[model samples]
Target: MRDLVRKYKDFLAVKGVTFDVPEGEIFGFLGPNGAGKSTTIQILATLLKPTEGTAVVNGFDIRNEPDKVRQSIGLVFQDPSLDERLTARENLYFHAMLYNVETTIMKKRMAEVLEMVELADRQKDQVKTFSGGMRRRLEIARGLVHYPKVLFLDEPTVGLDPQTRKRIWEYIHYLRDKEGLTIFLTTHYMDEAENCQRIAVIDHGEIVALDTPENLKSVIGGDVIKISTDNNEEVLPVIKNRLQVKAEKQGDYIAIQVEKGEIFIPRLAVELKGRINSMVIKKPSLDDVFLHLTGREIREEGVNAVDRMRVYSKRKH
Candidate 1:
């Protein structure tokens, strides 16, 4: 493993996780609520040291050389950390100052960043008045003020509409393509995870699977068999006890991974006696992989899935 992050759970905790991050590619970490996404990011970012296994960022051991590690990475937290009262330009300028960029260089970089995020016209507008998308973009601009080689983005497009989310994906590619920035991205959105060059599926503090999105979905072993049951939870165990492949309760429906979804659907219809409310069957998804790995839907309403798993080696938690 090139870079490793590890955790140990004792009487006080509920989970332990470990994983290796490959360099110079967009590595997407996927999991449900409380899947230790934050814990992993903290160790990799060198913000929280691990309990057991060590992490190396940019060839520097995090435990031995945290300062060097800190200098190599930039992090965009899930929450907006920008100063609400300050104008966007001012916020960025302050970050440039902290990085010790010369005054002329800071001005040039500030203008470039404001233009990059499409906020050149409103550079003087208070951050409090900017829209959610704009604030998110500005936060990203602030993180890049020092030109870090690796960017750790924790749900960068949280609470954004579809159009804005897609736009951020374009910016993510821009970092990889134009700037050659290595990215460690953790996202609950399946579409966002698919944009990565590779993905590592984490659940219960360990990687369940890792591969390219297309490859992972394609080789998931079976077509999906879906049955819209009255109570998805009640019937899942009954069906799972007899089925030879992976099965899960998805919302108001029961989904089975089998060789032929159509065939399984008919068999299920015969066995369940009553018709379902609705039924749909298709190939697996990263969402499906996440659910199957963690036993819960990725889009379950009203829960921050990422925060649930990230519960180790934390301070001020």
Candidate 2:
């Protein structure tokens, strides 16, 4: 966790970030690539001491009591950490040994975790032979081999297919409900964050908002109004003062966060009748919240959408 913190902060990436993950809650860390989500997680997981602020996990300061914080949490990193050469069972066994689980409990617990993740059949197979999903499940099992009280999943389901991603979502709930483990997850996936008890949204290294999914959605006015238009250089400020909420210009669409789009739609329809070719109204999404806060798309500048989608994929989102 601490190592990850430093990796992201060496260039002074984070700024005035502060939040807490309550016990027994599935807390989400939401942000784009350079939003400082990873940097904060590294500190919380005891991987890196913050260059400034400090995080305390399980009552121990992340900077001064790193070992205590480490003891209380399990971390599954953004990058693949599993050994391709090792079989799933071997991987769990190795981690179990490192954690000093009692001999009698190690075998039983290993079996339990493997079965829980539905990787029991593949326990004997080398990770390299497994598909992307299999390796991820095995990595999750390994993270749980020691049964730490809190588990940090960084972009938990990155490369898996839809079905696999859904399976992993169920597993995350299982960790919280059955195993009594508090799951700390950082993801771009709106669906995944919906499952969290609480969520903190960060942008540009600052936490923009924190609340349950419903509460967060409730903050936005009403239905979302999306317009097809351009010349953001011309329309943005006008819309901002008119709407009193965020107006994001993407390609030809200007998405506005409003309380009552039913009324705003018609009024806005007339206001920009010729400016925009068309408009639509729908429910708000995490994308809207993110846009409201940062005024930028999830895969903002420099990060290619397909490449970001393909590499981080379901893992973050």
Candidate 3:
């Protein structure tokens, strides 16, 4: 997407965001709730039109060739969209019909996808009888029924358990490595973002940072030293003045960012020996990278007014 913009009356939900995803790579949009990740995906999937700018998906321009764009992309919605009354196979068949998969190979394609997600055994069962994870897997299978070039997974494992989430990611990787499908996903889970070859961190409708996870974390430039003490208020300034390093109170610990935390730790231990309660050293993580860029931690939030407006507008449109 180049210079993509989306407006909801006075609120700008997506601000001139621009990026490209290499074919067959797992590309992630990482951010907290209401960060325009979904909006940008919707525009690319041809579910919503951008107010300005355009993107080409699978060799088709999103604006001028929406039908072709839709044909080339598969979508797994953030929310469940399966027909509970339909059987697993029925769901896949319905989706295949929508995408106009040739009748001669529809059943073969359905079986292939069902097996890919390990849901072949339960294909005849009603969707209502399936577990959350099972249903999610079925949804994924349904999305692939027509063999699209790109798959858009909007928070594919949002509410699944850790084990289930892991299994889902396994399937995602298999899709990329085995099927050679370009995977575009939006997520708030830092670990999930790590799975992507590249990530675009968005907040409040703008792309704040985009890079490989390793590269993004390198921006922190060193290890993180977290110190816990009884008198945080007194020790905070002392450490800042003594070491002349960046130190701030993060909850119960004073987080210090510096190069070579191991070298810094012993000197710190000696200087604050009597007062220090505990100390922990760790490498920088995606969470730290996000905090460093946004000046805040990612937190769950309800749908913002702009998101609500976008939804209502989508329905109206």
Candidate 4:
């Protein structure tokens, strides 16, 4: 989508943002909560229209051909979207009917999807009785009933256990490899984003960075050294003057980047023997990349309803 925008009255939920995904590629929109990731996905999936620009999903224009767009794509929302009273198989069957899957093959497709999610034996069980992971898997299976060209997964693994999250990723990879399906996913979990082929790091409705996980981490340029001291104010200048390294104050610690963090640590210890309290050295990560770009952690709590309401009020007047 080119220059896509979405406004909720004066809130401006999504800004002018644009990017494209290759066929059959797993592209991720990686961001913290409420960074416009869901809003962009909603527009591309044709559930919400763009206020300024447009998108094409599976060769169908999201605006001019919404029905075609809907036909070509499947969606698994962030929240559970299943009928608790219905059995797992019944849920899939209902979804198949809504998507107009051929009745002749619906049963076969239902069985296949159930088996794919490893829920075949439990297909007869009511959805309310299933665990959280099982429900998520069932929802994913339902999304594939009609064989969509692209699948949109919004926080697909949220609230799932580590084992369950891993299994879900296995199923996702299986679908991509077997069916050659294109997957567009939104996630706040950094670990989940690492599984994607490419990622767009968004903040405040803007793409701060876009690249492979390795490439994004490489942008940090070296190892990270974090130090804690009783007098951060006293140590900051001494380190800069003696080591000729720029250090950033983060709370009660100082963060420094160097080619070799281990070597830097020994030097730091020798130079300032009694002043340091604690220290850690490690390689760069996605969190570091985000902090480097935004000067704040991505997971920081964002604007609240009252703040948005203030903006809305100003716009109304």
lDDT of each: 0.77, 0.78, 0.89, 0.87
Show pairs that collide, candidate 1: 17-205, 33-305, 34-308, 34-309, 35-309, 36-309, 36-310
Tens digit per residue, CA lDDT, model 1, 138-232: 98888787888899999898899898888888888888888888899888788689899999876555677888999888766678767787777
Reference-based TM-score of each model: 0.85, 0.84, 0.89, 0.89
lDDT of 4 at 203: 72
Q: Give per-residue lDDT, candidate 4, residue 317.
A: 46
Query: Which runs in model 1 stand beyond 4 Å of their true positions?
Result: 1-20, 231-246, 272-274, 300-317
Instruction: Find the 10 residues in a row with the least total lDDT in model 3.
Output: 305-314
Tens digit per residue, CA lDDT, model 3, 26-62: 9999988888989999999999999999999998999
For model 4 the local lDDT of residue 54 reads 86
Runs in model 4 deviating more than 4 A are: 228-254, 271-278, 301-317
Query: Clashes per prediction?
Result: 7, 14, 0, 0
Candidate order, TM-score descending? 3, 4, 1, 2
lDDT of 4 by residue, 141-215 (tens): 999999999999999999899999999899889889999999999998887888999999987788889999999
Off by over 4 Å in 3: 231-238, 248-252, 270-278, 300-317
**Position 14, candidate 2: lDDT:** 73
RMSD, each candidate, Å? Answer: 4.4, 5.4, 5.0, 3.8
How do the residues 1-317 of candidate 2 rate in per-residue lDDT, one tens digit apiece? 22222334245557767666777888898877767777777878766667676677777877788877887888888889888899999989988898889989999999999998899988998889988888888888888988889899998886679999999889988888998888898987766788788888876566789999888877764787877765655777778886566677765677777777777776775766577767788898777776666556674434475455345433543
Error in Å for residue 223 of model 3: 0.4
